[model samples]
Target: MFFILDMFILAGIFGFLYGFLLQKADFCFTASLRDWISVRDSRIGKGVLVLIATAMIGWGIVLTLGLATVGEVWSMPIGFSNLIGGVLFGIGMTIAGSCASGALYRAGMGYIQFWIVIASMMIGNLLFALVYDPWASDYVMEPLQLAEGGFTLFQLNLPFLLIPLVIVALMLFIAFRQFGWSGVWQGAKDSLQDFKGNPFTKSHWDIRFVAVLLGIIATIQFVVMSSISITGPETRIAGVLLSFVFGDDFVYQNTYLNGMFADFPTIGLGPEETLVIFMIVGAFVSAILSKSFRIRKPKLARMPYAVGGGLLMGISSRMAPGCNIANVIPGIGGLSISSLIVVIGMAVGVFIATAYIFKMPLLLFQKMDFDDSGS
Candidate 1:
């Protein structure tokens, strides 16, 4: 009972932090892609690097201490499916104007378009479930296991965890040193500043801070995985509740149901689904407090973008074994090679879609003009 209560509390706190920071930072892959493709904004690019660097460092620490077993985290099969799935997910993000978590957070902010996007996502997931057989037969590489004993940085037989720690520390020092004291101070000031004037101010440094926090938050995944095995079911449960409230009677059956509620050592709800639901709730509560909630219909032409993008995410999440928030970070931190592939695929997908397909304009300039029009 106490452990269960602690899970709920930890989840709540985690969700709250994500909701608060995500809203404040406007940290959407969609926006980052837009900036990269259209306006050449490299802040988000820098942020991605920070996330990887910090995650690798943190993972090294956990490995040395034996605090958690990296062997348990989800990994991709690493082949054509990962590449294809990544491309599809990228396209969807461009069109929908957000990724899966981004959609939820925006929905919390009362964005009207994401209703359709989320609906499309669920539909896509259902379609994937139905067609999973062919996918299983054709594309999957043999599931990776730690027993195979492949070479890794740690596998090279380095002494003490401090070696990687020292390296990471040095790299971080160099990163800040390159920017100098003024840049460091400016970055610190900007992260704490109000969100009115310039959104990109000190964003490069802020990404590092966000990455560190995300790494800490990510440690919870170790606990979540050790305790649960019912990810898709939890997601389905939340979707069912929402669908029913909205008057939909879709009944999609999953084979994992009976096993989920059992208190057997290998059974329970997956963290991905639980985290997704609570994060949405946290975003909702945060938006209300920040008074940033507003409802507006998306442009008609953008509808296809939302629907198509969501469908792609559904397919990719299934193919890659998890979504960005779930599989990628934890997979990487846990030293799963498959997560690296998924991240690569996701990045490439974003690049191709943003550079070629969606081509959303650098709208920051236009947002100022839109404000000018109202004034």
Candidate 2:
């Protein structure tokens, strides 16, 4: 019970931090793609790189300390699923106007259209669940082998964690050297402040802080892993919850339950699943308090685009075995060749989504018919 309490506490803290940072940084990968493709903003990309670097460093430390194993990390197989699913998922994101993670995080900010998006997503997931049996039997790739055992840069005979950290840090420092710390000016401060004045300069210190927060989140993951030894489906926890609505046989096959539901049976929700729920709740509560909650109505005509995009997201995630956070962060940490493929898939998905699909002439023109706001 005390452990559960501790886990909740830890989850609350992490959730709060994630919400706070996300709100402040506007760290939506989908939006990042949109901004970069539509305009030209490297800040979002920089933020993502920082997160990857932080997770890598934290994961390396965990590996060295033997606190976590990379076995599960590399478990995802790469085959035709990689190319086909990835491309499809990319196409879905372009249509939906957000990625899976993007939907989760932004929904907390009170985006109303995401409400419909998620409903569609849930429907899409249910569709996946129905088809999973056949798909599992037929699709999926073989295990990928990395050159070395685990996630160390040493395996590749590269520099230590600090070396890459320093190099990246230096590059960012040079890039933002001239910015001011004000809200409206490039040289303004990066701290949470009103953007009423000059554009705030994002400080090196703040970047370091966010990076450290990300590292801390990784560390807490170790604690989470230790506290609850169960490693059932996490990304699909919502799917699991929805299974109840659909009479999931795996969850309630008998009076006592069975399958994945019974395989790792426990008294209550798993730590990570509970944590994810709290994260969403925490973000929502924070948004309400901060008065940042805003509803975005999808353009009526583009609704089909959103639906099509969402469907793609569902199918692709089912094929790829995970989404961005699921595959990339832990994937790189565990040094899975499949994850590297997923990263390639992610980049490919982003490019295909950004350039070919979302930015296409016909789609944009159609979208403009609904949202003449010139979004």
The Cα error of candidate 2 at residue 53, in Å, is: 1.4
Give the C-alpha lDDT of model 1: 0.59
**Quick one: best lDDT, which candidate?**
1
Pairs of colliding residues, candidate 1: 92-309, 95-305
Off by over 4 Å in 1: 1-5, 134-156, 159-182, 193-208, 220-235, 238-272, 360-375
Residue 220 in model 1: shift from native, Å? 4.3
TM-scores of all predicted structures:
0.74, 0.71
Residue-pair clash count for candidate 1: 2
RMSD of each: 7.8, 7.6
lDDT (Cα, tens digit) per residue for candidate 1, span 1-375: 113556656666676666555655556756665676567686875655555566666667666677765454445455555556666776677777787767877877788888677777777765665465435433442342222332234544574355556656786688688988788678767755554565333222255567666666666545443311122443465445544654332332332222223342333333434555676676676677666777867889988878888787776666665666554455555555665666677777777776667555746556777899999
